[model samples]
Structures are given as structure tokens and as C-alpha cells.
Target: MAEEKSRDCCVRHKKREPDQYRDMINRLSRIEGQVRGIKRMVENDAYCPDILVQSAAVTAAMKSFNKVLLEDHIRTCVVEDIKADKEGTVDELVRVILKLMK
Candidate 1:
């Protein structure tokens, strides 16, 4: 049942501003590159500590990305939904926040 609900939500979409979209895509691209660098480091037999540092950096970058996206969602999607009388959006946002926390 939970999976079905999640799937239902997946069918909905939001149109983001062009600048916001571009910024998110750019951040993801950088994170992707960082991940690839880390992979190369492993394949090249780099020192454990050095590879760990790069891994930590990628984790931090992903967290930063999530923060920006969450802020934008609250500022736009959540606000819009609430204004439209969609109280369920609050519950959805809470669920998402909890998931992110984990």
C-alpha cells in the first residue's frame, strides 16, 4: 500500500524555473564527476585515507544538493500546495524530511 501511494505521487510533476533547473543539473554533474574521480582513485590503488576523503566530499556535496532542493520545494511547491488547500502536502513534506534525515 505504501509503495502504491508512492507510485501515485510519482505520477505528479512540478515545473521548475529555468534557473533553478540549471543550477540543480550543474550541482548533480559536479557530484557525478566527484564520484567518478573516487572510482578512479580506487582502481588506481590510491591510499585508503585519500580515497576516503574524496568519498566524504561526495557525501557532503550530495547533502548540500538535497538542502538546496528542499529549500526550493518549501519555497515553491509546498507553499503553492498549501495555498491551494492541499493539506496533504504538509504530510508529504514531513515524510520527505524524515526520509532525508535518515
Candidate 2:
């Protein structure tokens, strides 16, 4: 069942390089920890301002993650697709960037 799930995921997603995958995973782990910390703070009645600051930090971390992912996608996926004359890739990329910017 686990192997089947993995295969299903891979079928619809790009296979990242080992280093890129590791970096993305590490960033997500840290973000996950940060979110749990914020939840704990809320449960423990942390000062409102302090919680807000931590929330902003989480937002920044998320933006940083998105920036890294977008750069990698453009460098690898976008470049490869464009080279292969996939015009739709450009449109797809534009739509994605627009959504991200929003």
C-alpha cells in the first residue's frame, strides 16, 4: 500500500534531485516545528504581540521556501519544457507565478 501510494505520487510530480528534495524537506520540517511552537504559544496564553511576531516569521519562512522552489522549477522544469518546444509550459508558468504573487 505504501509503495503504491509512492508510485501514485511520483506519477503526477517531478522527481527532484536528492539535494533539492532534502533541502525542501528540511525547510518544511522547520516550518512545521515553527507552526507547532506557535500553537503551543497560543495554548499557553503567550503575549499577543509575541505571537504575531512569530506568525510573521512563519510567513517569511514560507515565502523563502516558495522562492527556492520556484527558482528550481524554472531552472529545471521550465527550461527543459521550453527547449522541447512546449509552448504551454510558458503559459502554465505564468499562471503559476500569478497565483503565487497573489
Candidate 3:
């Protein structure tokens, strides 16, 4: 039988407080709506340049959000783990970054 590992390795960093989370959620929700709008534009055969511009906007929004999350992870999870000398944490972080690049 495969041994069960602790779930902490997969745990997310401590989340921002409720208000902050709500703000982030609201921003993401708007981005989601924008993406759906882009899909509808494509379905309706909108102008190519217009669709391309909207697509670019969505990509930028997603990248911005990802950057914020990555910064938070580095500040909270990575910094703490490194300070405590937790084995393999840095390697795990590097692997995650490589996956993100792809």
C-alpha cells in the first residue's frame, strides 16, 4: 500500500482577511465576465481586431492577478519556510515556478 502523506504540502498560504479576499474576488469576477464577453463576441463574429484587443486585456488581467498571488506566496509561505530551514521547500517553490512558466 502506498503510504499516505500529510496534506500540509498542498495547503495554501494563510488567506488575506475577509474584506481583502472579497475585493480580490470582485476583481476576478469582473475579469471572468470580461472573458465571457470576449467569447460571445467571437461567437457572434465580431471584428477580428476588436476581439484581439479584448483577448489581450483578459490576458493582462490574469497576469496581473497571478503576479499578486505569487508575491503574497513569496512573502508569507516561502519566507517563513526558508527561515525555519524546512527541507525541500525552496526546491518545491522552484518547481512550481517552472510549471507556471510553461
Q: Is candidate 2 or candidate 3 better by lDDT?
A: 2
lDDT of 3 at 63: 84
Instruction: Give the Cα lDDT of each candidate.
Output: 0.94, 0.93, 0.86
| lDDT tens digits, residue span 1-102, model 3 | 223345654555576879868878987998999999999999999999999999999988888887887887888889998999888878988998888788
Model 1: lDDT equals 0.94
Clashes of 1: 0
Q: 1-102, model 1: which lDDT tens digit per residue?
A: 999999997687879889988999999999999999999999999999999999999999999999999998999999998999986899999999999999
For model 2, the superposed segments whose C-alpha errors exceed 4 Å read 1-11
Q: Candidate 2, overall lDDT?
A: 0.93
- Model 3 residue 96 CA deviation (Å) reads 2.4
lDDT of 2 at 43: 100
Model 2 — TM-score against the truth? 0.86
lDDT by residue for model 2 (1-102), tens: 999999885554789889988999999999999999999999999999999999999999999999999998999999998999976888989999999999
TM-score of each: 0.88, 0.86, 0.80
